[model samples]
Target chain A: MITKLAYKNILGNGWRSLINIFILSLVLTGMIWMQGLYDGWSRIARRQMQEWEFAGGHYAHQDYDKYDSFSLDKSFAAVPPKLQDLIDTGDAVPILYSAGIIYPHGRLTPVVIKGIPAEQNILRIPTTHLRIQDPDTQILPVLIGRQMAKSINVVKGDILTMRWKEVNGAYNAYDIQIVQIMDTPVPSTDMGQIWIDYDKLNEVKALKNSCSVIVLKNQAASTYVGSPWNFVSIDQSMKGVDAMIQTKRVGGYVFFVLLLFLAMIAVFDAQMLAVFKRRKEIGTLIALGMTKRQIIGLFTMEGTMYMLLGSVLTATLGLPLFFYFGFQGFPIPQQMSDFNIAGASEPIRCYYSPIMILSTFMIVMAVTVFASWLPSSKIARMKATYALLGKV
Target chain B: MRKLLILTLLISVSVGMVFAITAEDILMNIDKNMTAKTTWSSSRMIISTRRATRTLSSVNYSKGNDISYSEYTAPAKEKGTKMLKMKDNLWLYDPSTDRVIQISGNMLKQSVMGSDLSYEDFMDDLELLESYTAILDNDITYDNRKCYKLILTAKTSGLSYFKRILYVDKERMIPLYQELYAKSGIKLKTMKLSDVRKVGNRWYPMHIVFKDELKAGSGTTIINDDIEFNISIPDYYFSKAILKK
Candidate 1:
């Protein structure tokens, strides 16, 4: 019965209820949009990293430290015999890293030369371009990314000289012909890096069947772990990316809290004013044998009804806008893409998952009900005679 | 007439033979002129880059060619920084950290105090003839003085530079110009020596400039304000314990 009364009261209130519903719906829509951006970005970052660099995970030589560039030369170890089977079967790819200097147009710049198999399909890296008719050609065929090409100012088919130290400390130099310029979003794979065939690099480096890292085709391939080869899981590799997103989400939370607070405040104020002006109605309800608790419930239900209606309005009006972002994606500005963070180069497609939407709705609805009940709870202390006279 | 021509030709040939020196002899003299048993010096380094220029003053002490110690005394930010070198090992003491850290392996290649000079450059104390085999090229005139161009190739694998082209003053036996090269035949650095002065019985360069080709800058210039060759330095100065003290 109290619910029926609350519904009728909400309708009769007209414009006041409409204002409250509009504010609630607006806040909900904004909250969901902000959440969709973060979710979409995180998802895209991990997916791209997995596709381009870490297919399943990495099995790196024990001495390899990404932060320590000096460790590159000594980081390689002989591939364990068991893992070699995976390599032969095309379920894994071995990579070698060498610290080298490139002379582009006779200007020197330090670069890390990574050697992968030309026929490897384990990762999205364009190693097929590294395939050459004769590996023993005096000029080595190399691949570089767009960012590196821009920084070094080189184009496809440009021949540059590269120098590196052998395992025994002898230095060698060769002419490298740029075969392909890749457009990769991952900065670690693109910037200050070059790609060449694995066999060619090993032959020049004079190391047989050795690699700095082995990229597995799937998580199940991690069983081939051996001494001097440590398996790095996908979660471990993505820790840095997760921390970055968490930091950004913390800043976004403050704005969301404020928006929700304003919506709740509007409902709270309206509830307080309604209780003040409707003293005669409260008295009439008491005289008509409706308990004071029932009267409070009626007011509380009215506030909740506003939220319920807002949710309905959000579903009807916000669907098209969500769909637009879902389809077209939000383009990242050019300035932001240069931040060196992975996945910033690509557009972020907003993903509104059911769980994310439902949780947001529940949290907002709870806050609204609490705001409505706080002001209405005062009726429990009022005397029937005093309320009839409209005395506070 | 034939007898007179033969006599004149013999005299000319004899003069050329008497004046010419072997590459080994030239290298030995250069070593003798540059290396001292012990030396103490106060010098200033002016490091210049495209963005800015920084000047640092330091006191240096060396024993033989293997042991050396230096402490920066000027430039408030760099003051109290000390470095000690013992053969292939190098240790740096920073006043801010109050700790001593050993720079080893590939870390030695890092620039010192943001200058074009690397820590490996400091630890490279082997005599030129000891590390490189000298080959004499044709004579050339530099700075209005006769100079012998000697191309030095490294005899070992682990040296910082694989080859060097040195221009040695014929009379003073001091290197006036040098070009350091990598094994790939690319010029990596150039050093110019000037302000030649006789200190005691040996000739020395009071001013030197070193340019790192891989870096973008005008390079570093070192000026010796005061120098004492063959002076006895305290034993404690070269000790690792002095790094913290």
Candidate 2:
């Protein structure tokens, strides 16, 4: 009998129920979208971070960088010679680099050029980043990011100039072939980066002996260490990249909350008015043999039925948006992508996170229950005569 | 017969004193020689798995300050370059643009060519005797050199390498082998010194071999190809204006 009454009240207002359901679904759609974005961004950031950390991210020490003390000393070549024998004898990633300065064609600015050999567009740098590819070299030389390449006005086939400077304030530039350009991965990297091939750079710098950094990876079972004037990290040095990746992720989380919060305010207002309009009816029920629990249950069930209808409509509207973006993300403005935002190196790709979507629906149910709480509890507390008679 | 016996005993005593030199005394002599500020020229080669790369440079090194000037050459490229360091300031000049720019401290973290050397490793001039006290650890043969195994403990913190055990040569007063230890008491690296040569009345290390503790199979070897010592170099070459490249 109670369930029958609950069903009647749900459709009691005819088209009014449709209006309420539409408003609630719209609010829910916003909440789901925002929540999905945040969760998606977080997963992408973590995956990318893991890749970089495994690639010697921990070796890029920021604390030690403050000393203003790094240079190539032609006098201290104590460690370079036997490096080849060890690489051949042991299993080690051929982590190598060569540094030089280059002035891109048309752009006269001489920039610090670097050539990194190996995979280019993966964890650390995303693919949408434009780089000039080398046509001839089997080893693809990369062009640095859009902003840097534009500033230097370098396409492909431009000659890069390298100058070896000594402590005596004298230096001479060596000409290097420009095979590729690399994008400045982050704002920090963008501020100081140029491009060339690793082999060509080694030749020009005459640094078959000098490499600025080494990135190495080998099978896990094959390693060991000694007196380290070096360092180790918590995420194994994942934090350096994490700090940058975090900037792009925070947006999605906040947007989720914004969507749900706005919907909640509207829900609260709608319920308040609905409950007030039904006061006379509630008063009569309380005056009769209906106990306070029965009155509260009646109003709560009616509100829940409306919410159930709202959720169905909301999910129908929301899933398609997710799939649309999952296939083809909304394009970010080129100008905005180029700007120096803290975490996002490139424009983001929007996608879905299953956990986020499920969690969001649960959250909406919780909010709907709370929104009904005030109205139902009031129904329980209504006075018999004043509530029913429409008293002044 | 009594006078002859006394003269013979005195001569024998003098010869014994001449042959016996304590490890501490030898270290003290090397420490003193290290104190003199001087200029020198050397060609160093970094030997790696990929290829051999070499740099020929003239250097002016000073004690207690990071002020030095190096005029380096790319023998392979027919190129010459100069760098100057005054205190903490560094600069390098681009002969192409004729422009000078300051180098950041981070560049030093890079490996010196294809070798096991860092930029800080190249500046390994401060002998432990000046900053730390040495104790004879034990006798050890390092790379076939008979050595007085000695342990050195730093009196101060923040040194480049804190705890080191050196296997010093018994005859030449040079460190034939060295073991570097971490703060946690783990051995970090092992280094061997070989090919000792005399330049201008003084003996200097001509070659060094280093092995990483973690990369057990891989190591670095550095050879100083050309060596000159006690040459004159200007002090002003070590300044901010000079480090710009």
Candidate 3:
């Protein structure tokens, strides 16, 4: 009976309750999405570093620091070409990064230039629905992010040009058509990013058969660093992402937490006000000898229902995107050329973790239900004589 | 006998010319100094759109000499990836292998971390006298500095970057500006080093600019804020093990 009464109360303030529900829905969805973004960033960096065979380890904080006297030419000179072969036989896949401006369609923004093998890129790269086929034409066929479409406002068929300085002091330009503007598993990759064949880049730079990183598959995968390869491991290469993900997660959490907090506050406030407005109605129930426990049960049931409905609506709208990320991943922006946090690699894909789901639900329920408790308990404390007289 | 004596005198004259310049000739005499060697230790904060990493390093070298060595402190992201240098040689220590390895060949031409110069092509400060014939092109003025524009052509057929025109300050003989050309005679890259400052007993160019003429893509300008030289630097600091250290 108390539950029915609570339901009628929520319906009486229908429009306001709906606005509150919508706000709560956004909060819940955002909380899940923020976590999603974090997982996506890590997953992409980890996988790409492994797949691309970035020369350094994925998690290790390897510093390729050049001091004041260190010249650009000498920094490249510091890491010799012979070390790659020695490290390749080990557990890591090292890749070097190059950042430059492209000139395919009238100079796109600066992009992350990933120097990697086409076949091996699958390991660390988040899965985009599009298949990027290397084209054999005067225009270099390139792999780009989905955000390339948005930033430059370009589409799939547009021909974009890429530029690089040749060793002989000439600028080399490749007028490549975008073969794929695929979705990356992570949103951060949605900018203007391009993946050129590393060998081709070397040919242009006049440095053939050499890369700068040993992106590892595991921490203990390789231990022999000479002759064939010399590099840090996968865990070693996440130097860029550790703090990055933490900060991003913190921001994401704060946004949703504050949002959810406000929604709960509003609910708690309204429910308390509703008790006073319905004081006379409560007094009548008390005079009829309705137990205090019964009244509290009614209110608790009503609060649970509201939470359930809101959660259902949020999940209904959100789960499909989650499943899509699990299956057909989203594409990143083309401009996000340097997505390798700590030199890991690009195209990190975040999958659904059961733990994340479980915790999110718990937090959402706990906040909403806990906020309803104090107000309902206050109503339970009233004396029957005062309650019937409507004076308490 | 006269001819033999004459030839002997000429040989002596050439040999003496090689070692004639003293530290006094190269230092403290010029009205404006151009470039010098410097040693530095610093930390870098790199921020991408969503990520940030800090890297620390100690570096040493002479500017005009064309080579320097740096010891890298691993970034939070790339731990166990070692970076090292000795003369022209570079090494990246791989903790996975526990071995100090040598960096060699083709990897040299790349711009270091997107810097203005190719880390591979410029290291060895190729002995100008040995690799090319340096001809005095003309005396000109650049940025109000009295300068000599020099044309350097490879003595051998296979030297990288077939020709270079350097606008060097006459007084300091520092190549203040340089234009590099390809075998096709196409202008390829331009470099300008300026903002000279004295660090220790020697004066050095505190700024460097590298622009790639060919790509029309991207370039770098290095501005050195603080500099020192010869801080009791140890030769062992240039070793491979130190790269990972």
Candidate 4:
């Protein structure tokens, strides 16, 4: 009975009720869109990281620390015989790392030298470009990421002087031609890094059959690796990307609260004014044997009904916007690449999951009902005579 | 008979002079003037960057090339910072933190106090003749003095510089100018030695400048304000414990 009464009241309120419904729907739409953006960014970042750098897992030398550049020289270990079989069978690839400096445009810049096999398909890096033959071995073919190439101001065919210390501490330097500039979304595989043929680098460093990391084709390939090599799982590798998305999500909370606040204030103001102007109606309901609790419930139900109608309107109004963004994707700016974020260079397609929609709806409805009930509770304190005369 | 004797004497003297100086002999003489058995010195290092220049003063004590200690004495920001080199191990004590850190492996190759010189350069204690094979290229006039141009190739793989082109002052047996090259034949650094001074029958350059070819800067100059050769240095000066003291 109260539900029917509340529905009639919402309709009787006319344009005022329509305005409240419109505001609620807009807030819901904004919340859903923001959620979709975060979800889309997180999804793309993880996928791109897996594609460009971490394939399935990494078997890194125990001494190798991603944070410590100084560990590059001492972190290499002899490839375990079992893991070597995987490499030979194309299920894995060995990578050697060295700390080096490159003179690009005659300016010295520090770089991390990564040596990957030319024939390996474990990662998306264009290592095949590193296979060119150099007559007399004067200038070796090397690969640089686009960001690295840009920062150093070089392009394909530009020769840079690369210098590094050998395993025995002898410094070796040579001219390196940039055969390819890889456009990788993952910063770890790119910025301040150089890629060369694995055999050539190993030979130059005089570290035979040794590597700093063995990238596996899948998690199953890790079974072949053993001591002095620690397996870094895919989840473990995505920690950086996850942390970045989480931080962004936390930062979005303030915006979300403001949107919710706008809708709540509108509903709260309407409910307070309705209580003030309809005191005679409230007194008649009390005189007719309707309880104060019942009257408050009716008003609260009306505010919740606005949310329910707003949800239906949101579905109607938000469907086209969601579909457009879902298919077309939101274009990311080019300058975002400087932040070293994975997938920041690519468009993020919004993902509107059912759970995300339902939760947002429930949260907005609860706040709306609370705002309605707070003002409606004043009916319990009103005297039937005073309300009957339309006095406060 | 007198004419024949005079001609024989002239030819014999010329032959003796030609045989007197070989590449190895010149290297030995240069090494004797460059290195010392024990030495103590007060020096100032001036490092120049594109933006500005900084000068630091220090007192140095050394026994051979393998063991040495330095403590910065001037520039309040750098004062009390000490470095001790024992063989391949290099430790730095920063008074700010009162901590000593051992720099090893590739860390030794990094510049010292942002200077053009690296710890590896200071840790190199081997005599030139022990680590390199010298071939005399030719004679050249350098710094208005007759100098022997010699090319030295590393006899082993682990030496800092693979090849060094040195211009040795013929009279003083000190290298006036040097070009340090990597194995790839690219010149990595150049050094100039000037202000030659004699102490106890040995010639030593008091002013040395080192320039890293790959870096953009005016380079670093080291001036030895006071020096002593073959003098007894306190044994405690080279100890690790002395870094904190």
Give me the candidate number with maximum TM-score. Answer: 4
TM-score of each: 0.86, 0.50, 0.46, 0.90
Give model 3's TM-score versus the native structure: 0.46
Clash count in backbone of candidate 2: 47
The reply for model 3, stretches above 4 Å from the true place, is A1-211, A216-220, A224-255, A284-298, A313-353, B1-245
Residues A85-166 of candidate 4 have per-residue lDDT tens digits of 8999998899999998887765667789999999889899999998957546878899988888888999999987888988
DockQ class, candidate 3: incorrect
- What are the lDDT scores of the predictions, listed in order? 0.87, 0.53, 0.58, 0.89
lDDT of 1 by residue, A319-360 (tens): 887888788888899989876677788888889999999999
Between candidates 1 and 3, name the one with more favorable DockQ: 1
TM-score of 4: 0.90
Error of 3 at A145 (Å): 10
Q: What is the TM-score of chain A in candidate 1?
A: 0.93
A1-392 per-residue lDDT for model 2 (tens digits): 66678678767767766776776687677666654554444444444444432343222222223112242222211113333343344322222232333434321233444444333432254322223364333232444555665666666565554333322222224444434454543443454454444444444334453344333343232222222212333254445445544564566557656755655565565556667887787777777778888877766666676678888897788678767765565455777557654224433455555676677667777876676666667666567787788641
RMSD of candidates 1 onward, in order? 4.2, 19.0, 13.7, 3.4
DockQ of 4: 0.57
DockQ of each: 0.27, 0.06, 0.05, 0.57
Error (Å) of candidate 4 at residue A190 is 1.9
TM-score for chain A in each prediction? 0.93, 0.70, 0.57, 0.95
The model with the greater TM-score, 1 or 2, is 1
Stronger candidate by lDDT (1 vs 2): 1
What C-alpha lDDT, on a 0 to 100 scale, does residue A168 get in candidate 2? 24
